[model samples]
Target: MFAENKLTEDFGDIRNFLLSEREKTLSEAEWRFRMRGYGYNLKRVDTGYEVARMTTQQVIGTLDL
Candidate 1:
């Protein structure tokens, strides 16, 4: 149950990050760099999803406290 909660929270954080970044005027490379810094990789999939799991390990780590 805890893992489920964590996943949900992570998804929310990811979505929020994407929305906020969309408002910025960043180049593709810069945007990917920023997302990587937050433990996410941005990609445009055929399903309309814009996030891709590029690394098995979280580069920026988790935010749990």
Candidate 2:
């Protein structure tokens, strides 16, 4: 199933489910912050998924952590 909500830009309440369930679920705000801060985010590729650097568009592979 496709989730249309994920496409929205609203960074929902930080003190709600996101903050409380970070260990189980990664919120949009947290991922965006970490991705931009580290210059990378998980990207979907033809083969699968990868950790790509935004500025250079380089696929740096996946990370388990």
Candidate 3:
């Protein structure tokens, strides 16, 4: 995330770099909300993303039978 091509020492101190990352990086909630537009309701756990598609009413109704 701190690669030279992305953020070099010329940018300034580490604190400023981290602040910039915070501004640029999306939170987990933001990611989930964005993914939903493409038909995915995912979540981040531990170190990876997982879809909780079963929670949708369509899925639940389909599985009810």
Candidate 4:
């Protein structure tokens, strides 16, 4: 019975983690859209993605920076 309870708790933790990660990803995507409006080229890469901002000059000076 204790094992079953532990398993349920573990699953709940996982669900929470997934929900938070999804919210974070959505936020990043929204930010990317806003950046694009300002002549910024943004691409979404899903593998261990980290949110960052590039200076306008940096973006203009490089193809991939």
* TM-score to true structure, per model: 0.49, 0.38, 0.34, 0.28
Model with the higher lDDT, candidate 3 or 4: 3
Q: Rank the candidates by lDDT, best first.
A: 1, 2, 3, 4
Clashes of each: 0, 0, 0, 0
Ranking by TM-score: 1, 2, 3, 4
> Per-residue error at 32 for model 2, in Å?
3.6
Q: Candidate 1: deviation at residue 40, Å?
A: 0.4
Winner of 1 and 4 under TM-score: 1
Which pairs clash in the backbone of model 4? none
lDDT of 3 by residue, 1-65 (tens): 13223633332433343334436547856645644553444444564544434236232111110
Give the Cα RMSD of candidate 2. 12.2
RMSD, each candidate, Å?
Answer: 8.8, 12.2, 14.8, 14.8
Candidate 1 local lDDT, 1-65, one digit each (tens) = 01212554365566656556655746767766766665566554454445655566323222221
Task: Estimate the overall C-alpha local distance difference test score of candidate 3.
Answer: 0.39
Model 2 C-alpha lDDT per residue in residues 1-65, reported as the tens digit of each score: 01122432233322232233335436655654555554545554576445555678765454333
Model 4, poorest ten-residue lDDT window? 56-65
lDDT of each: 0.52, 0.44, 0.39, 0.38
Q: C-alpha displacement of 25 in model 3, angstroms?
A: 5.0
Whole-structure CA lDDT of model 2: 0.44
